[model samples]
Target: MRKSVLLFVTFVLFGLLSSAQQTKISEFDLYGCWVLENKKRPSTNIVTYKLCENVAHEDVKFGSKISLLAFNESEHESTGPLACFTTFTEKGTWEFDENSRIASLYSGHEWLKEFKQLDPDEYASWGSPEKFDKLKFRVISIENNQLTVEIIPKQYGKKRTEDSLE
Candidate 1:
């Protein structure tokens, strides 16, 4: 009976550890930078994407949502001298769930002041009409160093990044 109990406990512990590993995504795996591949708005099939947009997620030391997103205007057909290499960056923090492979960026929190960096207007089509909300992205697939994520629309009471970020 003792041996049987011990074996059952070991199995339970191992299962818990395995589930924990699958639950949370490590910051190290996302230490570098990731760009936006696709962004579907709140209520429309009109997907907003970037050709060469990049999101530089540095160590959390700098700040939250400090990741930079450089959007190529040519993809939107609004190309111009100042629009070609413009970039829109997040101004808050980043939280990721490994089990769900969802990355939520709390942007639109603060205003940006970089002259070279494009304003959030470039990403006007990304999020919902509400001014206060977080950007939720679920990883579709990761292959060949390319991470494709789908922008999840925010529902009622989903404003800002919450603990129930599903």
Candidate 2:
């Protein structure tokens, strides 16, 4: 009876550990328009992954009080204040690795240039992509239509900042 009880306890502990190790996010859950919810400034920051079907490239639309930038194959017109804002549009791609839990955004130089203009200090510090061409983030969680990602600092080889989106 003592041996049986010990085995049962071990099994329960193993089950709990395994369940805790399971990931909360999946690749399929990442297909949508994720807007930056915790922006340092009041701006429109959006990242779309497979959001629009039949489109060649993924979409990333970021707009500030001064400028608006888009990375997409199709033309996306923004009316009102966004239209009047200085605009830059292009094509981009994105990918996700479930094993590493990394989401990579391959928006080009224009996006980076505009991003630098939007926040020069941030761009100088950690916002600049180590690879120059791709920005990688580890998907921390996806709950209640919100996605939280932590920037994977490639150059500094450390974790930098978190970006929450909904």
**Clash counts for the predictions, in order:** 5, 1
State the lDDT of candidate 1 residue by residue for 100-135, as single tens digits: 777665533334233114555655544423233455
Q: Whose TM-score is greatest here?
A: 2
TM-score of every candidate relative to the true structure: 0.37, 0.48
Q: Could you say which candidate leads in lDDT? A: 2
Candidate 1 wrong stretches, greater than 4 Å: 1-25, 36-88, 108-131, 157-166
Runs in model 2 lying further than 4 Å from the true structure: 38-89, 109-134, 154-166
Clashing pairs in 2: 72-90
Residue 51, model 1, lDDT: 23
Error of 1 at 41 (Å): 12
**Cα lDDT for residue 64, candidate 2:** 13
